[model samples]
Target: MGFNEDRKRYLAGLEDKTYFMLGDEACAYGAIFAGCDFFAGYPITPASEVAERLAEELPKAGGLCIQMEDELASMAAIVGASWTGGRSMTATSGPGFSLMQENIGYAIMTETPCVLVDVQRSGPSTGQATKPAQGDMMQARWGTHGDHNIIALSPNSAQECFDMMQECFNLADTYRTPVILLMDGEIGHIRESVTMPALSSIKPAARKMAKPGEDVFGGEELVPGITHYGMGQNVHVTGSTHKANGMRDVTTPHVHEALVKRIYNKIDDNREKIIRVEKDISQNGQSKIGVIAYGATARPSLGAVRAARDDGKNIDFMRLITIWPFARKQVAEFAKNLDMILVPEMNLGQISREIERFVNCKVVSVPKIGGVPHTVEEIYDAITEVAS
Candidate 1:
């Protein structure tokens, strides 16, 4: 059978049961089920719970969990673990996310498969240690220097927090790159009922393995297979510009261009498969207004859209499940048939500006910061103003 059918059967075989849990705890569960055999992370607010729960659970599952000295070491540790053929990950907040940028770039250059969970909080240096914010939206895409592509998913509720973590790991393995679960503090700490699949029935996806003598770094394929350490493959992985065989070729412009383009195109070329969005758009040509949101802002946006519809208003609503590679085509298609698109985010129009790139309609950004999520009434008011 084909890969897609096999994946569907594996998922359908999982036994699911509901549990009331924190978003952070659910992430821990998702990682374990996704066959994460190594976790190395340092404790940080809003994200500490992920490490804490993994510390308690991983060992029982015969997995290793390490509380690293800092975010840099934490990131480096996971990269090393993945080279040993382990599905590895780390969890951290904004400051820690920043500290890992260099290594994150290294992971991309090396084509490592791993997951990074960023439970975002108010930032620009510890704005509020305890509260949540969606300020890290853009940073997840461009925090690391140079031209590259990343896959980031944002969860609006605790349930999504659990569900998306597995998808993150799968995408990482499939693409052979680091994937980020861009969770905000609100959803990370929020308690909700999550349906978790039984561990015994879980079957996670695996990355392609390079056979001996095969080029593990690059080849005719867009994403080359990877070889673990001690695999009898003469693999030379480096951050410098390299050829298809993974040898350093720092002085050749075409070599650098070819390698970088392949890395970027691996994600860009597969945007249709990578991007995901949830839409409740009006189809009767009655709505001229649409609301687009992600993360914490999505919760209230949905509520407001429903309330507005109850009040006889024609408004469409969409929630972005996949945050990076920018969902360019999906947003553009969502913008069609609308005169105005309202974007409510916890940051100052981070994603709205991206939407403006793809559509002809007037884009309105309802930005909120200082650790507060947009309320349903406020979003409803915005919809009403646009409709009037």
Candidate 2:
């Protein structure tokens, strides 16, 4: 947890000032940028670049990157490596993401720390490879087939792609949970100039370093924090259910309740500190219209807001940085006195449903899933079209 200047310099040295990277490239850089020393993945677009680069770059930095036979092996390998005391990660798109679900559930039950990057594409089943889609928004949280709470983040810009990694690693390390860095084709393929972040500013925040036998899930002081693995620690992980030591404990209601509650409370306790949403609140809460968007759609959304305002329509904007635990409390407070709340997304109204559950205002969804991002003109028209 303590910062080391030499380690910081080593990471800083990896950044190149003259180079620009695609969304997938930045995704790899961001993970490596966040202290991930091990990567295991099978190639799947539009996320393949992340794995390709890791294979090339990781070894030079004294790290390891492996291309597994398939997504199943990829997921299993990272979990094993993570428990053996390496900070590991893997990347996949929709079909591969589906393949990784069973092992993902294993990671969840085992309380193993790792990262999974899913650069989403349009899909029901291998629906679209070259096309962009956000259909996996719900899948990231609930795809693994269980009643479990998880952490997932969605970044709209290439810069946020890098920044969210710092937060993602922090969440994974602190909770010893599998954290999802969710991106879609637009942000993953799109390229932009990202000024390299300084290590002094972006420190590697890891789990609590207690000997595993000492305490895996420490009391409130280290709530949900991971104690480093050590020999004789005897951690056994299973997908059914488990105790803090990671052994299956399905028989007792108390252990079951305690297991579930600990998972829920640790995240809840950090919600304020973890959840982030950017606001473009208009003056005096007098706005007549509002739009909430995430992912690549947010790019056009900002212009759409401007277009609406120019036509004498009162509009405000909300951009989500954290997706999984939907920021309801903040969204609720922002909805007061608003006539309507609009959600512009690539998928068929995933977040809109969540918004309606919390806010009294009408939730209007402008949804399209064509494997591409919403055009500024289309979004502008949607705003003006809805306003009229």
Candidate 3:
């Protein structure tokens, strides 16, 4: 019997139940329920709970969880685990995430399927180990030092942290690429009610295994299948520019161009299916103000929007669940009915600048830093200021 048999046996024993858990705990549960068979991680502040929970739960499900010497090794281990046909994952914070960028690029180039949970803390040299921040939005996109595209999701609540973890794994398998669950210390540490979905109802996405003699790296399909190392296949894997069969081809101008383009287009071409945003525009035709937010900041953004609405202000709101691929089309369409869009984030203006690129409306970045979350009153004031 293989992993599928073990997975079925593990899931069959689970029952649907509500649990009061931190967002980090929910992330671990999500990975287990999503059929994660391997986890390799290094303990870091605000993110250790994700690894801790997995350490306890994964063995019960016949999975493996190991702590590596460091973040780089943690990332490298998971990528290697992925090539062995395991659903692998890891968790880390700002400093650890930075250390994993090189290997992350390797995973992207090799087209590995893995999930990375980024429990974000204040940063740019460990600004605050225990504090929350959304400063990594751009880093998650461009930190690897290349023109590659990525799939990243941000969760605003503990439930979302759980739900999105499963989605993150599915997206990684479907795209044959690394998927990121972008969490922050605020939500990662906060305790909330999360109802576990029945294990019987779970439909975890499995990677498309490469057939013998087929091109595992590339082919007619934009996203190619993968041949596991132990499946009696002598497949070559490398970080350099490669041909369809996974052999290095760094010198050919066309090969490099085509390979890089497909790596990008695989995700870019499927943006519609990948991008997800929660929109609330009850006064669509009449509302002139709108707010766009993601991660822990979106929690307060929602409260502020509701408070404004209660005071007779018809302000629309958009909460971003899928952070990468930008959700530009959604934002542009969302902005058409409003004259102003307020972006509340923990960073200065990372996403606000992105919103400005797509929409003609005034995109004001309501930034809050210094290791604290934005208060409802603070966001509400920003909304009411524009109204006045």
Best by lDDT: 3
Colliding pairs, model 2: 132-371
lDDT score, candidate 3, position 205: 75
Scored against the true structure, residue 74 in model 2 reaches a CA lDDT of: 96
Instruction: Give one digit per residue, the lDDT tens place, for model 1 in 287-367.
Output: 989999998889999999999999888899989999997887888887888899999998889999989999999999999
Off by over 4 Å in 1: 1-15, 199-201
Distance from true location, Cα of 219 in model 3, Å: 1.2
The deviation in Å at residue 56 for candidate 1 is: 0.5
Q: Model 3 — TM-score against the truth?
A: 0.97
lDDT per residue, candidate 2, 243-328, as tens digits?
Answer: 66666778989877777677667677777777888998776567977899988988899888887777777899998888867798
Q: Relative to the true structure, how large is the alpha-carbon lDDT of every model?
A: 0.88, 0.81, 0.91
Candidate 1 lDDT score relative to the true structure: 0.88
For residues 323-356, write the lDDT of model 3, one tens digit per residue: 9988999999999978999999999999999999
1 or 2: which has the higher TM-score? 1
Which is superior by lDDT, 2 or 3? 3
Q: Alpha-carbon error at 234 in model 3, in Å?
A: 1.1
lDDT-based ranking, best first?
3, 1, 2
Colliding residue pairs in candidate 1: none
- For candidate 1, the 10 contiguous residues with the lowest summed lDDT are 1-10
**What TM-score would each prediction reach against the true structure?**
0.95, 0.93, 0.97
Question: Could you say which candidate leads in TM-score?
Answer: 3
